[model samples]
Target chain A: MAGKQQQRLPREVRERQMIDAAVRVFSQVGYHTASVEEIAGAAGISKPMVYIYLGSKERLFTACIHREADRVVETVRAAVHPDEPPELGLWSGLRVFFRFVADNRDSWTVLYQHARTQGEPFAKEVRAARNRVIAEITAMVVAGTRMPGGERIVSERDAEILARIAIGAADSLSDWLLEHPDESPDSLVDRVTDLALVGVERYNTGDLPPS
Target chain B: MAGKQQQRLPREVRERQMIDAAVRVFSQVGYHTASVEEIAGAAGISKPMVYIYLGSKERLFTACIHREADRVVETVRAAVHPDEPPELGLWSGLRVFFRFVADNRDSWTVLYQHARTQGEPFAKEVRAARNRVIAEITAMVVAGTRMPGGERIVSERDAEILARIAIGAADSLSDWLLEHPDESPDSLVDRVTDLALVGVERYNTGDLPPS
Candidate 1:
């Protein structure tokens, strides 16, 4: 019966289980501190099985990073509605990003901290993912600037800078949220979105009127 | 006379040499990748002497962090004249920060990336040093808002967020500059400060005019 039950689960299911276990271990102990034995134990399998399924530790880590980053990008992309104004789309995207991070803190840590330091290929993978998001943000800013009767304010170069600045603000706030785990993700998102949009609103407005 | 010829240098001089060596090693290889032997070798000293002088690798890291943080804070603080308006103060401080990162990229990387990841004590050390700089920024933001007779704009909480955003943007840009090494520090500072100040100025203006 045990052999039949093990056979019933597909290879994909087992692979996911291994990846989940790898993410948890990598996030908790970081890449170097984490070991194959611990990950296998966490996955409820033998070390040899992990090697067989994932090929190697480095491969396993790469797999985890790909999955986590894809999850984040998909969630953020799904939150944006094509018909919606750029501001609303961006706000929704930011909300999704915060909620994703809050729900999957471990996965986010694995992708951002662990993968970033594992050397070239993995770092490039993560950077490509980040750049994709940044590019989408740049597009949104460029679109948002074309409101009817509104003067063309920020140049493309400045718009790119604005997108990076927005991402930076959100990333920093997320880091702050990580330290203060007691804070609810909803309230944190509200504060972060407001602060971020306020900066955007400021950028759209060319001059500061005399107070 | 021959036996007494080998005299140890003064403690301060030796400490500086150790820190300089440490910054080079830590920034190059990261925390876990660097070894005490490498540090001592870089300093042209015996491993035993490094241990005797700086205690352990951990203590030596702490000392290096303190020294760099102090230099960063002092440089920014000295750049601004207190009598200048808050906006100018912030601009000058930003300029100083950019120049400092340009001149001492290694020191900045060691403090920001390597020390930040090692654990709580070192992270706290960096955070404390960072908050001191952030607090000064917060003060400037609060003061700048008061000039316009605007409705209590830029709250203490928002000011803190802004400070984090500003510093994070600078740090991310500095990291970006690592890849684009040909970019001049002055041009980078000019562009970033322009983006930041425009955001600040727009906030003081009551309405978010779509421009």
Candidate 2:
């Protein structure tokens, strides 16, 4: 009956099941201690089938990182509306990001904190993910700096700098968020929004240089 | 003659030489590729002596991390004066930190960029080092929030958030500094200081919440 059920499912569906189980096991026991047999058992499949689907434990972990990274980037991107003012877009994006992390603590742990320390291909994957997010943010910030007259308030370089600062602060605060489980994501957004408002106010006042 | 010099030197001096040589070799070839023989040869000592002095390759790397972490914390601490305003103190500390990374690129790479990805004891050491720096910044920020009339404007929690932002920005910017070799530490400091000033101005205007 199990074999019949497995044969009925497409390879993609089976692969997803394997990855889902892999993320749970990896997050619980961590990469070093997690076993392929355990993951296969959790997914209700044979060990050989698990290997056939994902190739190996290392590849399985990498797949988890890639999938989770995509989810995070997509979540933030979706939260931001291009028509809204840049500050509001940034605020909304941050709110969703924190919510995502809080909701998917397991995925977050596996994707970021664990994968980062695992070295090699995992670290490379994490860096690539981060660069993608930075690029998206750079675009948003650059767009925000433009005036109705087509004048640019912040230079491209400064815009990139701001994006880097925003991402760094977000990354650091995510770790803080994980540590303080009692604190809600909305409260964090409020605190950060309050802090960012000061700088945004200055930018609006022409305190920043023109590009 | 080498034997005679080895006998003449104290244990601490010999250990320092080994660590210095280890830092250079590790930075050049990375931790995995670095061999004790090369480090010993660079330090003009025997491989057996290297093991005797530092136990194993792992311990040697740990020692390098400890020494360099101390150097960074001390350099930044020395630059920050308690009597100065918090903003100036932060600026000066950041300046020295970038200078330290610029002057000792090898140390920074081995201590931060490398050790962080190596996992296990190395990652633990890196976290401990970061915590120490954060604590120092938090204290400075808390002090900065005090008014001349003995009133506090920012709450302790808010002060911690400020410190995290500052450190996260500094950490992220340091990577940017390394990537852009043409940019000087002072130039990076100037850009960051400009951004920080806007927020500081807001804080001065009583825009933030009072404790």
By DockQ, who's the top model here?
Answer: 2
* Model 2 regions more than 4 Å off: A1-9, A196-211, B1-9, B148-150, B195-211
For residue A168, what is the lDDT in candidate 1?
71
Over the stretch A125-188, how does candidate 2's per-residue lDDT look in tens digits?
Answer: 9999989988888788679757899987566776677777878888888888898898899898
Per-candidate Cα lDDT values, in order, are 0.74, 0.82
Give the candidate number with the greatest TM-score: 2
Encode model 2's per-residue lDDT on B1-211: one tens digit a residue.
Answer: 9988777688889999999998898898889999989999999999999999999989999999988899899999999999765656767888899999999987787778988887889999989998899888888867875778987656677667777877887888888888889989998877766645634454456643321
RMSD of each: 6.5, 5.2
Two-chain complex of model 2, DockQ on C-alpha atoms against the true structure: 0.33
Docking class of 1: incorrect
| Candidate that scores best on lDDT | 2
Interface DockQ per candidate: 0.22, 0.33
Model 1, A99-144: lDDT tens digits are 8888888778767765655455687777788788888877876766
Q: How much is the lDDT of residue A191 in candidate 1?
A: 64
Worst 10 residues of 1 chain A by lDDT: A202-211
RMSD of 1: 6.5
User: Native-contact fraction for each model?
Assistant: 0.24, 0.39
Note the clash tally of each candidate. Answer: 0, 0
